[model samples]
Target: MFRAARPFIFRLDAERAHWLTVHALANAPWAAGWAADPVDDPVTLMGLRFRNRVGLAAGMDKDGIALEGWQRLGFGFAEIGTVTPRAQPGNPKPRIFRDVGSEAIINRLGFNNGGVDACVQRVARHRAKGMLVGINIGRNKDTSPEQAVDDYRYGFEAVYPVADYITINISSPNTPGLRDLQAEAALDGLLGALADTRARLADAKSVHRPVLLKIAPDLDDAGIRSAAAIALKHGIDGFIATNTTIARPPGLSAKVSGEAGGLSGPPLAEKARHVLRTLRAECGTSVPLIGVGGIDSPEAAKARIADGADLLQLYTGLVYHGPGLVSRLARAVSTS
Candidate 1:
């Protein structure tokens, strides 16, 4: 179905098609529990039980609005948002682009979304029917570094009830001073508050949902190691192997390379795996890792598991390869 419709979808601006795709999928009968049955792998990681191994990455659904639609598409899990404390229009139009030849994308979408209150209501009303769900949280674009912890805390507290797991987004190169939070002191402060918030929210007769940190692919060895250590010290639940990369490694044409944004898709596979392996070794096997970045095929998904990613995510791959990507990845992970 997607293969046949690809040309039409491709003809519209990337952002418009993205919303149209969401609405179309949401209205499809297959989005409900009875229609789209879960894949059989039954992955259990970070205290959440997912029906399949493939997850829709953070950026795809920047607000909670698309969960029902993404759910209909057969994903084992769908992560929505990089949602901020307050609403804001993202970067100007033309912020998202496709690199057709490279099977990649360059996006500088600066965490656009309605505020936490509106997002929570939207997800509560129209969330995915039966798949695992994660909410990725971020600070407002103008939120100062000194007040970053408060922003993450507000997001954590707001989404805690609705989310299956909460992903703290400190990566995205488009947000100024956002990556600065990755520094040792800044990360420690942020995670410490979030962990405390998690504890306060988990007193029920049930398990506490995991709180994962999404890191950047651009970090050096020292930075990666420091981030892992802070995660351990603060008892962070898991790690989203990477966000997106500002550095375009090699092999793409000069025109696409000149686009200023985080470059993702095939070129991100190896670097993401490197971060996954390193964090795995540092955090030990106990802390689960959900790998993202360049996971378009079964081979790439399997490679991520080999490199220590217990769960997986997809974005650009879905754009280039189409909707069947999740079912195909679930089969590969199950057989492996």
Candidate 2:
């Protein structure tokens, strides 16, 4: 069904088509039943049980509007947002571009979420049924670098009770200076603040939740090790490697490839894989890792598992391979 609709959907503007799809699923979650049922290869990590290994990456559902829809679509887990403390309109128009020939997308959407309060409310209503749901949090674009930790703290507190896990998203290239948080000094401060906050919250709330860090694929060898070291130092729960890439690969000839933003899709597979491998080597299996990049096929998914990813996520893969890819990957990695 997705294959048949792909042509018509592709004809529309990339972002428009995205909303149409999101809203459709939002209104009629049963629509997800068209895809195969999710596999039952349970895994326990970070003290949370996941029905399967494949998850919907953060950017796909910026708002928590379609949690049930994603569950019905056969994802074992779904991550929503790069949500901010306060609502913001995000970057200018024409921020999302699609390159069909290259099977890639360049987006500078700048987090454009409905704030943590709104997202938390939506998440509270879902009741989670069978899917493990995570909320990805980020600071508002206008928040200065100095005050970033406060914004993240606000987000963490707002979403903590309702979220099964929380992802600290500092890797998006579209957000100005967001990546700087990955630096050793800045990261230590940010994660240290959150670690302290989490300790307090865990005591007050009577429950402990895992916090994962999402990093960009553009980081160099030294940078990757530094980020991993800091994450471990702060007792961070896990790592999602990675978000997206800014460097264009050799053969990407699509016109939009030149667009200034983070690129995701087939072209990103190698770079993302490298980061995942590097993180695993640095962290040495002590921390769990979630691999997200160009996993559009069963082979790519299996490769991620072989490379030490405890789980896998899909975004651009769904764009190119359709919803059924979720179940296929779950089955592929379930036994691997």
**Largest TM-score belongs to which candidate?**
2
lDDT of 1 by residue, 66-142 (tens): 67656666788888898989999888888888877788889998988878888788777764466677899999989
Minimum summed lDDT over a 10-residue window in model 1 is located at: 29-38
**Candidate 1 clash figure, as a count:** 1
Question: What's the TM-score of each model vs. the native?
Answer: 0.93, 0.98
- Candidate 2, clashing residue pairs? none
Predicted candidate 1: what Cα RMSD to the true structure? 2.3
After aligning candidate 1 to the native by TM-score, how far in Å is the CA of 60 from where it should be?
Answer: 1.0
Best by lDDT: 2
Error of 1 at 318 (Å): 0.5
Q: Among all windows of ten consecutive residues in candidate 2, which has the lowest summed lDDT?
A: 123-132
* lDDT score for residue 262 of model 2: 94
Model 2 residue runs over 4 Å out of place are none
